[model samples]
Target: MGESRERLWTRDFVLLTVCNLLLFLTVQMQTPTFPAYVKEAYQANDFVVSLVISLFSLAAVIARVFTGEALKTKSSKILAIVALGFVAIFSAGYYWAGSIVFFLLLRILVGIGFGMGSTTFPTIVSNVIPAKRIGEGMGYFGLSTSLAMALGPLIGLGLLNWFGFGSMLIVLVLLVAIIFPLMHFIRAYNQLPVSSGNAQTVTGIRRFYDKKLLLPAGLNFCLSITYGGILSFLALYGKEAHIENVGWFFLANALAMVLIRPFSGKLYDRKGHIAVLPPGAIFVGISLLLLSLTTTESLLLVSAAFYGLGYGMIQPSIQAWMVKVVTPEQRGMANGLFFNSIDLGIAVGSVLLGVIATHSSYSVMYRWSAACLLLFLIVYFLSQLAAAKAKKAAVASENVGV
Candidate 1:
C-alpha cells in the first residue's frame, strides 16, 4: 500500500490528466473571450453579457444535479464522451448564432455537456490514483486545469485578434473534438465491487448526492464566487486601471498555482485540511482586497499570485477531502455535488456582481467579493470545529461499543 501510494505516475493517470487538461483548456478559453464577443457582436450591456455567460453556469448546475445518478448507470468514460459530443456540437453552433438569444441557447447546450464531462473526469481520475495519495495525485491533476486557466483566454483572444470570432469558435470546437481520439488512448479502471451494505441503501435523490461534501463544497463556492467576479470583469477593470493587458493576471495566478499545488496537496495528505484550507482562504481574501486597490501593474500581478495560491491550494484540498469521506461507489455523487456547487456560486456571483458593479463600481464589487471570502473563512473554521467535535464523539461512542 505504501509503495503504491508513492508511485503516483502511471500511463492511465497521465492520459486522464491530459484529457482533463484539454477539456478545461477549451472551457477556460471560452470564459473571458465569449463575454467580450457577445458584448461586441450584439452591442450588449454588461448586465446582458453577464447573463449570457452566467446562463452557462445555470445550465451546468441543472445538468450536474442529475449527472451523478446518470453515472451510476454508465461508465465515467462513456458519460464523458457523450458530454464531450455536446460541447463539440454547440461549439460549432456558435458560428451560426445570429443573435444573443440564439447564442444563449447554444451556451446552455454546451454547459450541459461541460458539467457532465467535467464531473466524470475527476471521478474517474480519483479512482485510478492510489487512495492514500489521492490528495497528491489530484494536486498534480489539477495543474491541467490551472494551466488552462492561465492560457486558455490568452489563446482565445490571440485567435480572435489574428483571425476573427468564427476562427476562434472553430479552434474551441476543435479542442473539444480532440478529446474523442484521446479518450480511446485511456484505459479506464474496472468498476469497484459494491458492498452489500451499500447496495441495500435506499435509492433516491439523497443517494445521488453526498451530504458529507457540503462543508468543503460550500467553502469552495465562496472562493469561486470571487473568481466569477474576476472572470466577468478583469479585462474591463484592466482597461479602467490603464493597464496594457489584464490577462497577465491569470497568467500570474496560474504560475503561482503551478508552484504551490504539489506542496499543498502533500501537506493535506500528511497533516489534513487544518494544515492548508484556512490559510488558503485568507490568501484568496487578501488577493481580492489587493485587486480592489490595483493602481499599478505590479500590484495587479501580486494580487494574481495571491489568488492563484489560495485557489490552487484550497480547491484540490476540498476535492481530495470530498473523495476521502466517501466510498468508491459514492465518488461520482460527491464530485457532482462538489462541481455543481462551484458552478452555482460562479453563476450567482456573476449576476449579482453585475448588478452591484452597475450600481457601484468594479472596485467596490471586488471589495464585496473579498468580504465574501472573509465570511467563508469564519464559516470554514466553524465547520471544522463542528466536524472535530463530531469525530471525537464518534470515537467515544465506538469505545463504548455502539
Candidate 2:
C-alpha cells in the first residue's frame, strides 16, 4: 500500500504538475484580459476579438503535430523550457502591442510556445509514471489545467481592474518564469529509454491515423468544442445579459473540478472507462442545455458546476482510454493526435460560435452547443457498442481455441 501511494506521489509527478499549472495559468490569465485588451487598444469589434482568441488554437494545432514528431528525437525538458521561455517573453510583449497586428503576432508566438509545452508535458508524464497508474497520474496532472482555467480569469480580471493590463502582463511573466527553474527537477523523469540498435524510423503521418484511436479522439474533439464555446463567449454573454459577479461562475466551475478530479482519477483506476465516461457525457449535455436556458446568476453558477464536473470527469477518462489503446512506441503520436483533435475542436468552435453570436444571440450559441452534445452522446453510445462487440468476438475466438 505504501508502494502504491508512493507511485502516485513521485517527485517527477509533483514537478510536472507544478510546471503544467504555471504554464496553463499564464494562458488562462490572458483569456478574458486579451479580448478586453484588443477591444481597448485597437478599437476592434467582436469579430476581431474572436479572431484574436481563435488564432491561438490555429497556431497550436500546427505546432502540436510538429512538436509530437519532434519529441521522437528531442528532449522534452529542453522543448518545455524553451516553450515556457517564449511564453514569458511574448506575454510580456502584450504591454507594448500598440496595434492589432502586433498583438496578433505576439499571440501567435505564444500559441507556438503553448502548443510545444502542452504536448511535451503529457508525453513526459507518460514516461515518469508507472504504467499501472497512468490514468490516475494523468488525471492529477490535468487538474492543473482545469484549476488554471477556473481561477486565472478571475484573478486576471481582478488584477486588471486594480492595476490595468500592464500589471496583468507582469503577473503572467512572473508565473511563467517560475517554470524555468522548476523544469530542471523534471528533467530526470522526462527521458524515455533509447531502443537498442538504430533509432526506429517512423513512417508517414498516417501512423497517427489508427482506427482504435478514432473513438477517443472524436470524443476529445467534441468535448473541447463544448468548452471552447463556454470559455470564448461566456464572459461576453454574462456581460450582455447583465448577470452580476460573472467571475463566480468560473470560480464555482473550478472548485467543482478540484473537488471531483482526485476521486474521479481513483475511480478511473479502479474501474474502467465504461464505468465513468457515460455519466460524464450525460452531465456535460445537461450542463450545456442548462447554460442555454440560464438568465439569472444562480442558474449560470449551477450550469458552471455541472459543466465543470462533466469536463473534469470526461477529459481524463478520454485521455486514459487513448493511452490504453496504443502501444508504448506509438503513445507520443497518439497523444499528439488526441491534442490535435482538441485544438481542432477549439479552433472550429471559437470561429463558428463567434460567427453565430455575431449573427444571433450568445444564448443561441449554447443552444447549438446542446445540439452538438446530442450528437456526441449518440456517437459515444455507438462507439461503446462497437467496442463491446469487438471484445466479445475476441473472447469467442479464444473460447473456440480452448
Candidate 3:
C-alpha cells in the first residue's frame, strides 16, 4: 500500500526546496533595499533607482525566453548549479559597484542567473512530484519564496542598520554559496521526463513562448505591477511617511501568504479558478486601495495583510492553472511563460509607477495601482466568459454529431 501510494516528499524534493529558498532569499533580501543602496551609493534619482529594479526584471525576462527553450536540451541540474554560481559571483559584485552603470550591469547579470535558476528549479520540482498532486506540490514549493519574501528584506534592512551594506552583500553571497553543494544531491533532475511539447519542430520565438498560458499569465502580470510598486518603493514610502515599523507590512504579508498557501493550492485542485481568482484579485485590489490610504502604522499593517492574502492566493492558483491546462511536455514552457509574465509585470510596474511617483506622489501611484487591479478583475471575467463560450460551442457540436 505504501509503495502504491503517490509520494510528495523525497530527499531530492527537500533539497530543491531548500535551494529555491536560498536563491529567492538572495533576490528578496535586496528587493526593498536595492534602490536605497543605489541612491546612497550613487546618488541616483527616482527614475534611475526604478531603472535599477526594472533592469533586473528585464534581464530575467530575456533570460527566461532562452531558458524555456533550452529546458529540453539542457541538464536542469547543471543549469541550476551554474546559475547559482553566477548569482553568488554577482552578489559579491555589489561590494565593488562604485558607479551606477557598473551596478546596473551587475544587476542584469544577477537577473540572468536568477532567471535560468528559477526556471530550472521549478521544472525539476514538477518532475519530482506525483503528477496528480502538482498543485499541492507547487504550493509547497512556493513556500520557499513566500518565506524568503517575509524574512529577506527584514533581514536585509536589519543587517544594513546593524552592520552595513557590505555585510548584506556578504550574506547574500554566502546564501547562494550554500546551495552550490546541495545541488549535487538532487536525484530527480535527470530522472524525470521533460515536458511533452515538441521543441525541435517549433523553431525560433515560438519555442520560447507559449500562447495557451497567456490568460493566467496576463492576470499575474497585472497583479505583479502593483506588487512591484510595493517592493520597489514601500521602504521609501515609510521613510517619507515617518512610519518607523514599515517592515511590518512585509511581515504581515508573508505570514498571511504562508498561512493561505497550503490550502489555496488544494482549493484550486478541487474547484478551479472560480474558487480562487476573483476573490484573490478582489483582496489584492482592496489591499492596494488600503495602502493608498495608510497614514498610520496599523493601517500599513492592515494593507500588508490584505496584500499577502490576495497575492498568496492568486499566484499559486495561476501557476497551478498554467500547469494543469498544459500538456506535460509543455510544462517547462508554461512555467517559463508564466514567470516571464510576472517579471514583465514587475519591470513595467517599476518603470511606469516609478515615473508616476516622480511626477505625483506615492499615494497617488498606489491608488492608480489599485485602479489597475480593478481592470484585472475585468480581464479575468472576460477571459472566463470567452472560455465558457468556447467550451459550450464545442460541447454543442459534439452532441449534435453524436
lDDT of each: 0.85, 0.80, 0.84
TM-score to native of every candidate shown? 0.91, 0.89, 0.90
Q: What lDDT tens digits, residue by residue, belong to model 1 across residues 1-402?
A: 768645779877888888889888998888868888888899999788877767887788778767776766677777887899999998899898988899999999999998888888888888788877888999999999888887887898899889998898888888887788888877764545244473556476677666777788888888889888987788788877788878779889999999999999999999998899988988999999999899898999999999999998999999899988877777877888888777778777877887899999899999999998778888988887987999999999999995
Each candidate's root-mean-square deviation in Å? 2.6, 3.0, 2.6
Q: Which scores better on TM-score, 1 or 2?
A: 1
Model 2, position 369, has a per-residue lDDT of: 80
Q: Against the true structure, candidate 2 has what lDDT?
A: 0.80
Top model by lDDT, which number?
1
lDDT of 3: 0.84
**Number of residue pairs clashing in candidate 3, backbone atoms closer than 3 angstroms, sequence gap of 3 or more or interchain:** 4
Ranking by lDDT: 1, 3, 2
Q: For model 2, state the Cα shift of residue 148 in Å.
A: 0.7
TM-score of decoy 3:
0.90
Worst 10 residues of 3 by lDDT: 192-201
